[model samples]
Target: MALLHKAHITPTKLELLAAWLPARPWYAGDGPLTRVAAARFDDPAGEVGVETLLVRAGEGPVLHVPVTYRGAPLDGAEEHLIGVTEHSVLGKRWVYDGTADPVYVSTLVEVIRTAGNEAVEEFEVDGGRVSREVDLKLTGSGAEVAPATEITGHRDGDPTVISTATVTLNVNRVPLIVVDPADKGVLSACWTGQETPAVLVHLR
Candidate 1:
């Protein structure tokens, strides 16, 4: 389960993204961004913050961005740093591109390999617990495991593919309205306002 605390964050997520998104080679928008939905993945050790955000700029395509927050810098991952932000509850945080974090990469791969879904989230507010429904639903295929040698992103395709030594993971960076199932191992999601589930990742 993913637990969320009512804590403050400096340079809020949107503010940080505004400055960061425009620099990405895959970003195709130049307008104001609207957050569509978000979901979290639990860190069993309870040290890192893992979350995925779905946002759109005006009428543009919805972008899927997964980020990982850590209290300390990740060694050899300086190139993937998304910038740092202070958390009210957790002091200084070192935010990194989720693809470069082993925890995030493993969890994501595990989710797709085990036919798992998004973790249930609960919000703690005013000493009361409120169940938060995930606006997006995710599912992974139960495939054989293999140690990932390296994971790299490919932007030349329609649905960007994150490739590893043993598998090719396709991510729907720009989501489509239509729903279609893949013939191979995949990671898919369905949103509340969409008529069909979008295949977010495919493993083969």
Candidate 2:
């Protein structure tokens, strides 16, 4: 389960993405971005928050952005750092590109290899717990894979490539809404305007 706080955050996520998106070579946007939906994957250790935001920049196509939130900086990931933000309840958080984060990579590997679903989210409101409705639903196709210990990530234009010695995951930064029948052993998503699952990542 993913615990979400109702507390405020300075320089909201959109603001941070807006600033970072323009610098990425694979990103295509000309104006302000609007949140379309979001998906979350739980970290087994519960120390990291892994989230993927689907946002549209003005009239542009929806973009896939996966980010990880941690209490401290991820060593040797200075280039992937999105920005540090102050969370009212969690104090300070270090945000980084999920592709470069080991926790995100591990959880994603678990999801794909186990044919798993996204996270169960709950919001702490008024000292009470309320289930947070997830607008996006993503599933992974099962595969036999070895656990990943090291994560190396790079971008091939639009797709972010996460690789280990035994496996390679290609994450589509700009996902298409259409589905392909032959795409197996992949992670797919189905959301509000998109009922048919779109291939989000291909593992090889």
Candidate 3:
């Protein structure tokens, strides 16, 4: 389960993304970034906050930007760091690129291999938790493979390539709309505005 708090966050997620997206090598869009959909995955240890955002500027292709928020900076991952911001309830959070986060990678692979779905998110309210609806409906493609223990390498590009010992995962930076004959992949997603499923990641 993903627990969220209704509190003020300095430099909101959108602001943070707006500031960071322009710096990416492959990002080429103008105007403000609007979120098409969003989703989250659970961290078993309940420490890191894992989330994925599908956003774009103007009529550009949808960008899949996944990130992890932690209380402290991750050592040896400075290159993947997105930024730091203050969360009223969670204190300071260090955000990193999710493709470089082991927790995110493992959970992503697990969901695909087991044909599982995203974690259920709940908001903290008056010392209790209540279920919250997410925009994206994610579906994993089941495959028989060894567990993905680590992310050996990842190249951020149009089709981001992530490699592990067991398998190499290819993530599309620009998510394509579902055509009649859709391509197969490790994961797929759909939202209210989207008519059909869009392939997210696949084995390379």
RMSD over all Cα atoms, model 2: 1.4
Question: Pick by TM-score: which candidate is best?
Answer: 2
Candidate with better TM-score, 1 vs 3: 3
How does candidate 1 score on lDDT?
Answer: 0.76
TM-score, prediction 3: 0.93
Candidate 1 lDDT, tens digit per residue, 1-204? 887877899978887778877777677766898898888887778888888788887777888888899999999888778889998988788887676677777678878777788889998888888999888777676677674546664343445566776777666677645654544466667776864777666676
Q: Which candidate is the best by lDDT?
A: 2
Ranking by TM-score: 2, 3, 1
Please provide, for model 3 over 80-161, each residue's C-alpha lDDT reduced to its tens digit, 9 standing for 90 to 100.
Answer: 9888999998899998888888888888888888888878989988888999998988888687887798888888886778
For model 3, give the 10-residue run with minimal summed lDDT. 176-185
**lDDT against the true structure, each candidate:** 0.76, 0.86, 0.84
Stretches > 4 Å off in candidate 2: none
Task: List TM-scores for all candidates, in order.
Answer: 0.86, 0.95, 0.93
Ranking by lDDT: 2, 3, 1
lDDT of 2 by residue, 1-204 (tens): 888888899979999999988888888867889998897999878899999788989888888888999999999999999999999999999999898998888888889889999898998777889998899898988888887768754654578888887689888988866777666668898888888888888888
> Which segments of candidate 1 are over 4 A away from where they belong?
125-128, 147-161, 176-182
Q: Please give the lDDT score for candidate 3.
A: 0.84
Output the worst ten-in-a-row residue range by lDDT, candidate 2: 149-158
